[model samples]
Target chain A: MNAIVTVLRKEVRDTLRDRRAVLSSLAGALFGPALFAVFMNFTVERTIDEGEAAIEIPVVNAADAPNLVGYLGQHLIEAKEAAFDSREELRASVRRGETEVGLVIDKQFGTALGEGKAARVWIVADRANASAQTAVARVRGALRSYSSLVGVLRLQLRGVDPGVARPLAILNDDVSTPSGRSVLLLGAFTYFLLFACFLGGLHVAVDSTAGERERGSLEPLLTLPVSRGALVAGKFAATAFFMAVALIIGIAAFAVAVDYLPLAEVSMDADLGLVECAMAFAVLVPIAVLGAGLLNAVTAFTKSFKEAQSYSGIAMLLPTLPILLIILNPMQPTISMMLVPSLSQHLLITSIVKAESIDPLYFAVSATSTVAIGALFGLLAVWRYRSEKLLV
Target chain B: MIEAEGLTKRFGDVVAMDDVSFRADDGRVTGLVGPNGAGKSTTLRVLCTVIKADSGRARVDGVDVAARPLDVRRQIGALPHLSGLYPNLSARENIAYYAEMQGMPRREAGRATRTVIDRLGIGDLSDRRAKGFSHGQSIRVALARALVHRPQTVILDEPTNGLDVVATRALRDVILDLRRDGRCVLFSSHVMQEVAMLCDELLIISEGRVAISGTPDEILRETGCGDLEDAFVAAISSERESK
Candidate 1:
């Protein structure tokens, strides 16, 4: 145990002194939170702007549908009269980005309405254009409202009850809170946190294992009187220590960045307070250990530092798989998910962000399973280091 | 004392060491001499307990290598062909690290590091990081690291392979000092002159087998040669002809 501590101290000192390793690990911690802040800021500002922005529609004929135009004006959709010699010009204008939406009223619309026959009105828009699509919805809604108003008046004039046309009333009651809707946003932050834990110890893992081999230090170090198990334990401890540090920093940065965003305006709240951040760190400690052990074990088998680095780069992507799966197809966290280490930590993290209290059993299962996996990898590393082939 | 009996090692079909056997007594310097690819390094590695012999019983100070490797490692100070110094660590730190690994307490390790550095006349360079050290300086640090734990047996593979005249002389003095302190020293070298100058005894290997084993003068007398160099060539050639 003392030997392990000594080796751990040496490894930690060596890696911390390397400016490049320290900076790269911190890059994820700082960048993830700052990116989340920027994204939330953009979404909130865009939502508020969209609510106040007016829709503009270009109409080919304004005199034919005075009532239809009056209804649109009341809804803040301005009908700009455009002079076009042909209907093709109106559609061409919409296609050429000259207008977001265009409307054409048939010339026989008044004659048809007076004869009690259906009249045709066409709304021209480029569906691929987002603004044009939104404008088309607004124009269609206004025309429907005007047509209903005229039908109600006609029913009243015919001495029939206008209420007979109405059949049923429907109501929408939403139970989801602002925090509940922010799970996707918070999931991204959690993904970054997990990445930090996985990659934080990578440089040290590769440096102490394959780097030592390439530098010819492995044979000398192995020849010392210390047990191979102690040496590996020390290295694993140092690696997990760094990984946990990165996790803490990542979570803290996320808390500060998330707290700065004005999410209440958009009915979303990340609510990354002190207690929540602490809970997240607590939940992920075992995952950090698992990541460090697995990486070190893999690197121990590699022949050279470059090869180890390439291998570890692929290993770092392991955490992303679970996060991507959840993002692409979200599922509710179940007790069974707690048995998988990364998935468990992710679910726990999401729960923390949503201000939901998680089951203590889930935390216990996550920690125990992850630590068991980490120990398995650590034992493999020790066995490898003990082999005669290790010197090769 | 260091002893190996019938040490045989093979890598797939190539025999690295075949029926190799030798002994180096306490308070004497034993030189392992052979041409390139003659299994000198392989024999040294087996003795150091870094690699096990497929079929052999080796011991350092009466402790069997295979049965008690850590105990054997504790009694042996091993130096490979390369110095294997950490470029980022100072000479004192490197020596102290090995001392600690040998189970010495931190304070005791510090004292041992200082003693070895002073004995090697490297006190001036002891605090400087190895990155900027000269080849000779790094070799001195490596030697200090090896002796820091006060091992009963010292095994160095090609310690003078790349040293210049002055560095070689310095290394020879250190090996002689180890002998004076009653420690068994076994080192490998291809340079006949180096083996002839410092070794109290010699083991010449050829084609993974021992071709000759004796003192320099004894080898010369037995081979009917004038000098140690001709005696080595004659012994190797005779061994080849017999095979």
Candidate 2:
């Protein structure tokens, strides 16, 4: 234990002294949450602002479509970016990214609406791409609701009373925790954690091995009374400490980002209080351990500093797989799943995002297994230390 | 005390060492001098128990290097040909790290680190990272680390390979000091002059075998040469010509 402490302390002190190491750690911490917050703010603004804006369409004849397209145009801006006469050019323009959305109001649009016959309205878009798709969907929905209202009003204007046009009415009474919430806003926080873990400890691990060897300092280390195992343990501990510090900063940034970022005004389902944020931080520690272990072991095995760094980058890629999977599927956290290191924690992380309780058994398994896996990394680092090939 | 009895090592068909044998008393410095590729480092590595010998047995402090490998390692300080120093650590830290590994107390290890660095005139450089140190400074730190715990025997492979004039002389003085302290100092070098100047006894290895092992005077007399280099030339000339 004393040996390990001595080794760990040396590493910690060295890391604290290197300016580049600390700066990179802080950069890794802030980068993710800041980017995610910006993305979230943009998403909400796009939805609300676009919903209130005008829908663009080309009315072929002003008199022809008095009913649908003509009526809808009154409520939206009509941007005449393309001519309706050239079908091929319109299609090419959409394909070549000339426009996000396009609408064509046919010659018979007003006549068909007035006579209550079949009316054709064409919607043209360049690969909807979520934002454009949402705008199109909202615009189409508004037109449909307005048409029905106009139809009922026409009946009232003819002979019947306004209330008699519609005999029955439906009302939505939703007792939501937060009304009109976006799920992505909650998910951005988890993504931020994943980003911070894999990138934080990479440089230190690289510098400790290949950089040392190339500079001719590694030989002196091996000659020391310190056992190779102790050396590895010390190195692994230092890197893990750096990663943990980075992760803590990351979790804090995310918590603060979630709280202070304009998220209060936007509706969200999951709310992270002080206690919940603390739990999330507790979960991040084991993940940082797992990350630090793999990074150190892999870095030790590599031939040079650059090689170790490149390999560490590849190792970093593995953790993101679980995060990406969760983003695509968004499942509840399951502690029983132990196929990946800290995957069970990701499950807990996902639960935290959805405002669900963390599974205790899964949490225990994740914590135990991640710690075990981290020890295995230390064992591997020791094994590397014992090897003449790795030492060279 | 160190003893090697017909120690042999081979990689498949290529023999690195063949029935090599020698002894080093507990209170003397024994030098191993040989040309490049004469199995000097390989023999030292086997003696250090860093690698296994093929057949014959050897011992460091009466423990078999082959059979009881870790026991031999526990009693020996080996400075390999290649410097394995960690660049991030200072001279003191490097020495302290090794001392701590050898089971020296933290306080004692710290003291040993200071003593050696100051002895080698690297006291001012002790706190600086080893990355920028000259080859001489690096070797000084390595030597300090090697003796930090004072193992039963010291095995150095090409210790002064890259030393400048001043550093080389300083190293010779340290080797002499270690001998005065009565520690077994076994060093391998390519330079016969260094072996002649420093070693009280010499073991000249050639063609993966000890061509000569005796005092400098005996080698000079037997080979009919005035100096150790001439004796080496007189002994290995035929072999070199044949190759």
Candidate 3:
């Protein structure tokens, strides 16, 4: 036990003295929260602005449909006279993305309305353009409303009830809460946290195993009086310490960064207060052991520091695999899923962000199973250290 | 004291050590001299308990290397062929780290570290990080790290591979001091002059087998050569002829 502590203290001091390693480890912690804040804020702001802003669309023959243009103005959709003389020109401009949406009124529109016949009009738009879809929908809705109003007037003139034209009315009632709606966006937040946790221990894990061997220090170290198991345990503990530190920093940064997002403008709530941050830290910290163990085990197989680094870069992605899988195919939290390491942490953290109740049994199973796998990896590292080929 | 009996190790089809046996007593410096790839390093590794022999028995200070490696390691201080130091740690911290691993308390390890640093007369180099140290400076610090525990047996695999005149003389003095303190010292070398100048007992190994071993005068008389270098060559040739 004493030897483990001694090795841990020495490794920590050694890594701290290396300015480059320390910076690389902690940089991930800050990067995740900063990106989360900037991206989410921009998205929310754009969505809110798109809803209330008025849009302007060009019309090919404004003189042919003055009354239709006047009716569109009431819905905050302004119509401007097109510079082009033909409908083809309007269609070309919309296709080239110079205009979001355009209108082409038929020459006989007024005569058709007088005869009580269906008028011809074209709403020219590129449906493939995501930005133009909203504009197209708004213009189409205004035209449909104008047609319905004309129908109602024509029926009233005949002494018929307009309500008879619409037999039933459909209404949408959404039951999702504001916090629950934010869970999908905040799923990315859990990914960042897990990535930072893995990155924190990468340097120490590579340094203690492959770095020592490359430096030719492992041979002399093995000749010491201490058991190989104690040595491995100490190195693993140091890696875990760095990983936990990164987890804490990431959680704290997210908690503060979430406050700056315009979530209220979009009617979304992120439960990232101090209490939630603490809960997230609790749920995510157990994965650090698994990360440290996995890194150490992978690095032990490599012969040099550079080789270890390349392998560890791939190894760190293992825990994040569960996060990606869960994101792509979201599943309800179950006790069986809680047995997986990163997936469980992601689920528990998502629940914390959504302000949902968590089962204590899930937490217990996740922590224990994750730690058990970590210990197994740790033992594998120790066993490798004991091999005669380690010196080679 | 160190002893090996019929020690043999093989890596697949390559035979590294072939029935090698030798003994180095306390209070004397024993030199294992051979050409390159003569299994000098492999033998030292086995004796230090860093590796095990496939079919042999080796002991350090009367402790079996295979049965209780930790006990064997406790009695020996080894300097491998490539002695490397942690670049981020100072010389003192590196030595103290080993001292602590040797089961010393924090305060005691610090004291031992300072004592070893002073004994080597490398006070100026103790406080600086090892990143920029030259080859000779690195070897000196590595030697200090090995000796901080004051083990009963010292094993070095080519300790003077790369050293200037002054550094070589300093290392020679340190080896003499170990002999004066009555600790068993076993070192390997490919250079004939180094072994002649310092070794009290010499073993000439060639092709994974000991060609000859005795006092310098005894080897010279046995090979019928006037000089130690000629005797070394003659013994190696005769061993090859016999094989």
Give residue B21's lDDT in candidate 2 (0 to 100). Answer: 92
Clashes of each: 0, 23, 0
* Order of candidate numbers by lDDT, starting with the best: 3, 1, 2
- Give candidate 3's total backbone clashes: 0
What does the lDDT come to for candidate 2?
0.74
DockQ of each: 0.70, 0.40, 0.84
Off by over 4 Å in 3: A149-159
Give TM-scores for every candidate, taking all chains together and pairing residue i with residue i.
0.93, 0.85, 0.97
By TM-score: ranked, best first? 3, 1, 2
**Which candidate, 1 or 2, has the higher DockQ?**
1
In order, the TM-score of chain B in each prediction is 0.98, 0.94, 0.98
lDDT of 1 by residue, A197-314 (tens): 7778888899999999998888888788788899899899999999999999998888888878888877888887788888989999998789878988999999999999999889
True contacts kept of 3: 0.85
In model 3, how well does chain A match by TM-score?
Answer: 0.95
Q: Pick the winner on lDDT between candidates 2 and 3.
A: 3
lDDT of 3 by residue, A1-392 (tens): 99999999999999999999889988988889999999998899788766678778898788888999999998888888766688999989988999899899999999998888998999999999999887888899999999999999999998999999999887999887899899888888889988898889999999999999988999999999899999999999999999999999988889888888879788889868788888888888888889888989988888999999999999888888999998999899999999999999889988888898889999999999999999999999988998887778
Which candidate has the highest DockQ of all? 3
TM-scores of chain A, one for each prediction = 0.91, 0.80, 0.95
Which regions in candidate 2 have their CA more than 4 angstroms from the true location? A53-135, A156-192, A207-228, A329-335, A387-392, B11-13, B66-75, B237-243
